[model samples]
Target: MKERVQKALDGIADLVWPRICAVGACSRAVDRPGRHICSGCYSTLPFYAPGGACRICGAPVAAKVSHLFTCETCTAAPPCYERTCSVLAYEGVAEELVKAFKYNRATWLAEDFAELAEGAVRAELDSHSVDVVVPVPLHPNRQRQRGYNQSALVARSLARRLNRRMDESSLVRIRDTPKQSLLGGSERRKNLKGAFSVVRPAFVRGRAILLLDDVTTTGSTLAAAAEPLRAAGAAHIWCATIARAASTS
Candidate 1:
């Protein structure tokens, strides 16, 4: 009875106060009345093809080789994480939505973002192997200022959808590093070299970690965070992000 009542309340709330959708104004017609984004918009969002993508980094590649589409950079120097996935190209409305979530504290869009990510992850990976979900953590000060970690919200939603354990406290950001967006790749790597540490190593040991984040440009931050988990004996680390910046190099 309580569950039914709660469902009724939720339905009433949706009817009374619909959430602001994420589809752009031009695409508003594509959205359903109370949803975050319309099915059409969701369909139109850019998706990286699973084929001809780097086996390790998951970046798009021109051709496949040796049962993997290895990006040139990954071929030269590999990232720490075993695999990575992204939903959209980091531009236009996608970029704006990410900025709003991370800096403006527009957490209402998290569910929509998670839905998009979940689809991409399922398409790219076999879900049965995933054991835990971990969000990239922010330093305490930044987290307080922002009112929440956007990554954590996404991670929680993903955990619920996948019916997997969430280990938010397993990994932590011990150092406050300068923002990497403005820096070059080398500097970004330097900025994040020692920024992350695992708090409860036992929680992640022998488990496959599904790491969530908002975006990836140089991938320094994700790699840095993965280092600690890798050191703690994580079996496999797979990263998922909302978008990826197009690399000029």
Candidate 2:
């Protein structure tokens, strides 16, 4: 049949062609099987130093506090989320990865981001026994415009990897706020006030929740999103992002 011939052609074409790296701006072929990024590009991606990161925001701590000390901003005014873990500093190839995943609708990159997030959050997850995995919700308008929620994609992958329940219905965004990156920190917080609410309080009430996102600029959005979860009697809130814009210590 014609269908069988087409299938055979497709398979032969795949075997003959080299797989290109998925990281945008990289032209290299994938170096390893079952991977999208070439090893060379992967090595170039910015990574956090892994030690002495702030427990509150995952920012690099100047002095080695071993997770005991707080960063200037976090100590001055703590966020609703109890812990934070960002696997990479948002620069270089990491920034490219974020843009590709977030703007280019690269859903496969979600799997890579999830793997990075798992390495960071595994220690906490093992100790805390997370009850649920929640992705920061996008406004209905934005979701419709994009045809999918990036956070939901990353969170769904994360939950599956963690073997925890993923709940998209429990949290809802009531307002379609302006992009967080366009405003100052204060403006970002104000822009997000009353923007999120819990429609299904029963799901989060008294449960430890892990929040996932691709990149965090100021973390104002995450803090705002956690307010509703806190009010709903969630016992703990933790955040894990693919990258943070701040410099590593």
Candidate 3:
């Protein structure tokens, strides 16, 4: 078939001309097919070590008490979502990749991000069945300016890899809130209050949803997004993020 021939040609070309790493400063040649980050650079990513994070929020804890270890903060006030699976700590290369994919229009990195997060996602999915994959929605104005929603792109790739249906329209950002990067956790929660609305309640009710996002700090954004879903009668909501910010305290 012509499609097969083109794929073969592309594979051959990759061997002949290695692709450059996605990291802006580290443009070294990568030999892996369909991978933009070189193995050496990839090794430097801040992958979360097993049992080092809170099971509930995926935040790094001093030491995990059990498989269901919940951090003190999460134990005090649980997030809207049932659980979170984070692939990397938001520092070093992980932070760089998220920023580039989110703000610089480096949409191609979505596949790479999805691949990195796939294992954690699968681990979570193994215990609970998710009926739909939903990306944290971006305000129309912000999405129009960026030309794409970074989370949606990654969610689409993840959905394909997991063989799940992706629903991007059910969740909508109704308010154009201030950037959360500059705000503290409480302030960020306030900013996102009433910002999200589930437009299609029928599609989500009684369905277990896998919510996707690029990065999570205090989890305010993911929690806010899940609030509307919870109100709409979503059976259960679980969140996945490429990276989670290192605990400040």
Best by TM-score: 3
Q: What lDDT tens digits, residue by residue, belong to model 1 across residues 110-208? A: 888888889888988766789998999999999988889898998988887898988889899999988877788888888898899998999989999
lDDT of each: 0.81, 0.81, 0.85
Model 2 lDDT per residue over 1-249, tens place: 975786577566557997788877779877655456788887777886656867687777666665376778998989899988788888887887778777887776776777777777895544247888999999999999888888888788778778888899999999999887777877888999999999999988999999877678778888989999999999999988888887322
For model 2, the stretches where C-alpha displacement exceeds 4 angstroms are 1-17, 63-67, 124-128, 247-249
Candidate 1 minimal-lDDT segment of 10 residues: 26-35
Scored by lDDT, the top model is 3
The estimated TM-scores of all candidates read 0.88, 0.86, 0.91
Which tens-of-lDDT digit does each residue in 1-249 have in candidate 3? 975786688688788887789977797887566677888888888886655667777776675445667788888988778888888878888888888888888887887888887888887655248788999999999999999999999889888788888999999999999988888878988999999999999999999999999888888899899999999999989999998885442
Give the range of the ten consecutive residues with the poorest summed lDDT in model 3. Answer: 59-68
**For every candidate, C-alpha RMSD to the true structure in Å:** 2.6, 4.7, 2.2
